[model samples]
Target: MFKKKYLALVLLPLLLLLLAISFLGQAGATTSSKSSAPLAAGVQDIVDRGVLRVGVKQDLPNFGYRDPENMQYTGMEIEIAKKVAAELGVKIEFTPVTAQTRGALLDNGQLDMVIATFTITDERKELYNFTTPYYTDAVGFLVRKDSKIASNWEALDGMTIGVTQGSIQWGLLEEIAAEKGIHFNFRELGSNSEVVVALAARRVDAFSIDQSILSAFLGKSNQLLDIQYKPSEYGIVTKKSNTELANYLDQLVQNWNKDGSLQTIYNKFGLTPVTEISD
Candidate 1:
């Protein structure tokens, strides 16, 4: 009976040790599983699909533009999109979008996000998620060098100013007009190129848009007015239901802003973003 009792004691400790070891192994596995789990649904979806579909502007140089000669997209926003895709370990597919088409594409589930020069506003915040501003710029006017218009906003008071259709510039101009108690005519076109064409054809007295964008179109024939107004901030846009993706993008932007990555991109493109304009 003593021998049996001794055997039981030894086996008991052995069984307990095995049980403890098994439990510890399971706990470690649980931690590993949790740590290796997939990302949020929105982000995981992009990864599973193997491609990040980003909407970017093809017309605006330096910010986002497609080279017809080489059939390639190049710009600051394009670089940003490439970085995002690399983070997700996916290839990037660029879809050319304008101010009018970007929102609709996002709503229709055709684009994962838009990196175009989309300005953030409270009203728009209700409709879609916007990351923190990546770039800021103020409104300016581009006019023919030979035009009699002075190098001031007030000079175009009564003249027709061409603006991109569906852009906020029209409303902004109206606000400025009201504040100054001056009336101005506006011609809304579909794209920046069209507005520039209108200005070249004298269909509009001035091409009014963001100064950063105007800098791309400046040449010997046209000059940007020495005025600025209503500084607007551009942000990455995602669908309203994809706050997870927006949050991720926001964090990336915050990091880039702090680490001077964005500044490096601006310098490569010779872009000087205007954060504020003096009255």
Candidate 2:
């Protein structure tokens, strides 16, 4: 009987050891499988670093403009950046960039993404990956409320026009003017504020940019021409090779649409022409 008792005790420990070994083997397999699976490098990079660096505009109010009063970034795009960082479970560091530098910022890994009213285009796609667009921004002209070139091309044939460098309408405005035999001096500036300042100082008669930006200057300037010359879809821009991050952002946009969160964000800012994203 004493022998039986000793044997039982020994066997119980052996059985427990075997069970533990089996469980550990299964756990090891799971760990191995997960380790071997493809890692979302872009997302993982943000997670590992605990920060999501984003490129954004410094001017262009209502979209990505900064508050001069508090000197803090707070606009529709800024809010969107905040939401994206919150969703990614990380902190966001906003780097101010102009149209010319935004793509380059993302290309050199300086920014995880660009939410600076980046328009998705075929030419741009080869250089960057764009998530499903969150909104559509059209081309528009902003002339001073008292300017003579309010709407039409006539009566301002030789005036200077201001456009942001690297903006879709930058060269196109001049190109169209040349083609139409409406000669005008074209000034491509570094930022939207520069363009607006040029117009204010009479350095440029008209300022052309995205309509959403033109909306911000509503009371000060007349959006005389809301031409959808190039229907620009505002998309989140990422590195060309970072499709995984792009996909995640696409999914995030879809979910935002489904949950009405996107509309809420638009409503909070009292913005019109709120964009609806598709899956």
Candidate 3:
């Protein structure tokens, strides 16, 4: 009985050791398999799954709005994403997100990328990777030409302003107004079109949003209103770990600029193409 007990105790440790080695080997194999995948580092797993997950906003006109008649997404950024997906040889699965949640979606691995009309800023660069600017734009104000408010930035004082939620332009406009001693009340809207609707209804005195976006709205609505835009640039965004993908996109943008693809896209919408900077 003692011999039997001793034998069992000796075999138990060996069995456990074998199991530990087996687990370690499996872990090592998993790591190697992941490393050998075909997609970009940190992104192979997603590509291997055969879908490029994208976060886009359907609310923003001319950038990501969906076609009302067909319920298909057709906008400037959407076109750009489609091209990228083609190059990657993967299908695109778009996830709708608001300005407030876009960054969160990118960070959480829920999205492989974001090509929405996301403006690049110094602070945002810390949290995500930015492709080289594919387009330039600016924050601009929209007001009815017949309205009593001032036409330019200097003229806006004591007038209520309308801006969309989760827009950097909204916060910037408020600060500028406050600094200028302009007591403007800022109204938050869901989309740029809503902002224009509010202004037309006199629900708000003025609206501030991206200048190109405002241009698209004006072109479509043909409303009698004066429009203006200040200069800025826009870029694609990805999670910080997606450096390779971001760089790839930057290169693609460069090619687009050289071959007139970017200009062609802009021209299709009657938008003036901004010159690309080589640096």
Number of residue pairs clashing in candidate 3, backbone atoms closer than 3 angstroms, sequence gap of 3 or more or interchain = 1
Expressed as tens digits, the lDDT of each residue in 18-115 for candidate 2 is 99999999999999999865548878888889999999888777677777798789777888889988987899898998878887888888999999
Candidate 1's C-alpha runs over 4 A off are 1-37
What TM-score does structure 1 among the candidates reach? 0.87
Q: Give the TM-score of candidate 2.
A: 0.77
Candidate that scores best on TM-score: 1
Model 2 RMSD vs true structure = 4.9
Ranking by lDDT: 1, 2, 3
| Clash numbers, per candidate | 0, 0, 1
Query: Mind giving the per-residue lDDT tens digits that candidate 3 earns over 177-266?
Result: 667666667789987778888988989876777666666656432332343444467788889988887877788888987998887877
Q: Each model's TM-score, in the order given?
A: 0.87, 0.77, 0.74
What's the true lDDT of residue 122 in model 3?
87
Q: Residue 11's C-alpha lDDT in candidate 2?
A: 100
lDDT of 1 at 107: 98
Lowest lDDT block of 10, candidate 1: 148-157
